[model samples]
Target chain A: MSAPRPVYDPSWDRANPNEVRRSIRERGYTGYTAGLAPGFVQANICILPKDWAEDFLLFCQRNPKPCPLLTRSDVGDPSLPALSDNIDIRTDVPRYQIFRNGEFTEEVTDIRSHWRDDLVTFAFGCSFSFEEALQDDGIPLRFLANNNVAGVYVSTMPTEAAGPFEAPLIVTMRSFTPQNAIRAIQITSRFPNVHGAPVHIGDPAQIGVDLAKRYQNVGDPTVGEGEIPVFWACGLTPQFAVMKAKPPFCITHAPSSMLVTDLRNSSLAVM
Target chain B: MSAPRPVYDPSWDRANPNEVRRSIRERGYTGYTAGLAPGFVQANICILPKDWAEDFLLFCQRNPKPCPLLTRSDVGDPSLPALSDNIDIRTDVPRYQIFRNGEFTEEVTDIRSHWRDDLVTFAFGCSFSFEEALQDDGIPLRFLANNNVAGVYVSTMPTEAAGPFEAPLIVTMRSFTPQNAIRAIQITSRFPNVHGAPVHIGDPAQIGVDLAKRYQNVGDPTVGEGEIPVFWACGLTPQFAVMKAKPPFCITHAPSSMLVTDLRNSSLAVM
Candidate 1:
C-alpha cells in the first residue's frame, strides 16, 4: 500500500559511500543515513526551481555559518559530479520532503517522479563532519551517547536577508563540561565549512534562548548542572528561511536523510 | 640608600629583546617588564642549588601546563645561551626575589651577589606569549585594557608530586564575552609552549576557587556579568611548589619583572 517504509540494513553502517548510495538506489535501503559511511561527508539537501536559486545562493554566501555551500548541481541536472561520480540526485538520497508553496506536502523515498527540468539542487555542509572530528579528538558528546539529538532553538539573532529569504537565526545547542567545551571549540574551529566554532556559550538567555523552550522539541532539551550550553548556527536556518519565502515548489532531504559524498571529513578541515 | 627604583623608558616598548636586556644589565631599567619588547618571550626565572634542581625538573615535567620549562642553564653558568646569546641570569631579569629557608627574605635588582657555583637557573614559559596571540587575533582582554592583571586562584586540584615539590594548582582567570571567550580558546591552543589551552571554564567553585578570595590579592578579582571566566594553569604554581619544598636558598624573577629573551612569541605557536 505505502511503498513499504524504507528498511535499514545494519551492514550499511560499515559500507563505503558508493556502496551505501547503491543500496539506497537499487536495494531500497531508503532510511535515515546517520552513522553510515563513517568517514565521508553527508550534506543537507535543498532543491528549488531555477528562478528562486539565485537568492538562495546569496543567502548561503551571506550566512555561511548556517549554510556553508558544499556544492550545487547545474540547473536541470540530477547528478552532482563534484560530490560523487555516478551520483543521481533524484534517487541517491534516502528520503525526500516535498513542498508546494513552502508547505511540506508529502514525503517520498525517491524524487524521480517529481523531478523537473527547471530545478536546481543545493548541497550544504552539515555539522556531522565536525561532530565526528570532536569525537575523534576524545571529547565525549552526551547527546550521541544518550541516543538523542542536540537541542534546537530559535535565537533572537536575525540572519542577513537575501531577497525573499529571511528568518531568525536557528541554533543547535549542546552541553559540555567546561574543559571539554573548550576542547570542542578548538577542534571545531579547525573545520570551518561544517559550522565551525560555537556562536555562543554560557548563559542562553544572553542569546534569548530559554533552555526549556526548544524549537519543535527536536532534541534532548536539558542542560544539566555544571555543564555549559554551547550554541552553533544550524543548517535548519535555511529551511526556516525557505519556509518563510514560500517558493512555489521545493524539495529537501528528510531530517537525518543526507546526501552522502566521497569527500572525507578531514578534507574539509582548513588546518 | 637602596638602589634607585628602576624608571620606565617609554621608548623601550619598541626596543629589541637584547637591547631591553642591556638596559636591565647596564642602564638600570630594573622595573616590571610588562609591555616591554612586545613581540619577544618574557620568562619566569628560578635559580636553585643543584641538589634541589633535579626534583624541581621532575615537578615541571609532571606539571607542564603550569611550569612549561623553556630552558635550563648549566650549573655555575651565569649565561642562558639558548634564551639569548648575551643573557646573564644574574642581571638580565628586571628584579629578583630571594627566598631563604622557605620565606621571602628580600628583593634585589641584580642577583650576582647571590650567585653560587652550585646554583642552577631554570627559565619557564609565561602567559604573556599567549596573551599576545589572543590580542593579535583581535580578542579584547578586559584586564589588560584596565591595566590590571588576570585574577589568580589556588584550586583544589593538586600537582603531581615530585619528592617535596607539591602544591595546589594555581590558575590565572580571565573573563570575556562568550564569543570572544571561544575565540580566545582557539587562539591560545596554538601555543602549547606557553600555558596552552584552558584548564577550566564556567563555575569557579567546582575547582575550589572563590573568585572573591584571590591568592595574595594579586589581580582584579571581578568576573563581570555577561562574561565567562576562563582559567589557565599558571607559572606561579612552581613558585608555590618551591615555597612548600622550602629549598635552603632560592632565587626567582620578581612578579611581572621577567627575564626578556630573544625568542619571538610567534616561534611558540605549534600551528
Candidate 2:
C-alpha cells in the first residue's frame, strides 16, 4: 500500500508562499497544500478555451458566493499578473485534472504539453483564506486535526444559469457549536472575495443536504452531537457546472491542490 | 379601555426625526416610537444617581453587546449635545419608569419633576435600528404585523459584575427562516453599536431558554414551525442588572417608549 499521507507540518506555517510555489513547480512538493503558506491566498484554477470562458465568467458574476472570481488571465496567456509576477499557471500548480467532454480523463503534475493558444485561465478564491481568519480568531476547526477537509455536498439550491453553465450549487459543510457558528459567520462575512459568509446553517435537510452522504465522500462528514452544521458556497461549484456544461476540453487543479498566490488573506477582507 | 393602540401609520415613514421629537416633548405623541422617524436612531434611556452611575457605566463597559453606550449625559446636565443640539433628556423621552430601591414605582409621561443634580443619564443603542435594516432588506418580520415585540428571555449566560451590578444576560429572541436568519446576521453585524449580531441561534434549550417561558411573559414568545430562533443581547440587560443592584434611585424609559435622536440609522454602519 502507498505510504499514508503526511499530517500537516508546523514548519509549513512559516514558509514563504513564493518558495512553496517554486516547490510546487519543481515537483518537489506534490502533496496537497493545506497548511503551507498560512497567510497567503490559494485559489481554485480552471483553464478553458476562450469560447467557453465568456460563459463561465458570467456564471461567476451571477453567483458570487460560489464562484468568487479573484482574477482572470487574458485569452491564451498563462501568467496571472494580478495574482503574481513570477507565476506560470501550467507548471506552478502541484497537480492538474484533465477533463474531456465533462468526464475526468487524467491527472498530471504539469500541463505544459497540453497548453493551448486559445485557452483562458480563471482563478477563483478558495475557503482557505477565511478558514485562516477563523483560526486566527481562535475559533477551532476540528476537521483540520484529523487531516480531513470539510464535507462537500450538492445542495437543492439552483444557480443562476449563464449560457451552457448550469448546475446545482455545491457547498462545503463545517460543524461548530452555535456560539462559534455565529462568530464564523461574522468572520467569514469580512472576506467577500472568499465565499463570504455561509449560505445555510442548522438543519441540513432544509437545503436537501444529507450529512451522511457527502459528495464523492471526500472528507469526514460526521458532525458531533451538540454541534450545528454550517454550509458555505463551495469552490467546487464551478467545476460541477463545467461537468454539466460539457465543454469540449477543460482543465482544473486537482482536489485539495490549489494555485498559491502572493495575495495576503487579510487583503481580501472588504472591511 | 386604552382606545385600541394605533397600528403603524405610513406617514410616519416620512416624519422628520427632530419634528417627531418636538411632538413627543410637547405631549402630542405619547405612543410607542416604533415606526415614527423611520431612519433615525432611537435610544434606550437609563438615569442613575451619581454614586450608582459610575458602577453602572462600568457594567455597560464590561457588557457592551447588551448595553452599547451611545452617549452619557454630564452629571446633573439634561442636554446630550453629542446626540442632538437640542435634546433634553428629562423632556424628550415619551415616557419614563421610576424605580425605587430596584422596584419599579411609577410610570410617567415626563421626568422633569424628578430631575436631580446628582442624576446622570445614559443612552444605549437599541435593536430597532437593526430591525429597520432587516425590513429594508425585505426580510419579513411576522411579529411586527401582529404588533408584538420579540420574546424577552433570561438566558443562563451571566454578565460580568461591577459593584452590585450583576444579573443573567437578558436576550430578545426573534424567529426567522434559515435563509433570512443568515441575512439578518449579516445585516445586524454592520451595526455594532446596535447590539451587533446574534449571541446564539438554533436550539434554545442549549442556552437554558424555554420557548414557552419568557421573562415575565412579555411579548409573544411563540416560535413558528420550521422557523429558527435567533437570540440577541437585549438592552433590557442593563435594566435587569439595575434591578439586581438595588440602587436607591433609578429611571428608565418605559417599555416601547424611547428617546428619539437626529442620528440616522445608516450612520451607525461600521462598514
TM, every model:
0.95, 0.94
Worst 10 residues of 1 chain A by lDDT: A1-10
**First chain TM-score for all predictions:** 0.95, 0.94
Query: Which runs in model 1 stand beyond 4 Å of their true positions?
Result: A1-13, B1-14
Predictions in order: lDDT:
0.89, 0.88
Scored against the true structure, residue A93 in model 2 reaches a CA lDDT of 84
Cα shift from native, residue A206, model 2 (Å): 0.6
Clashing pairs in 2: none
DockQ of 1: 0.84
Per-residue lDDT of A239 in model 1 = 96
Number of the predicted model whose TM-score against the real structure is largest? 1
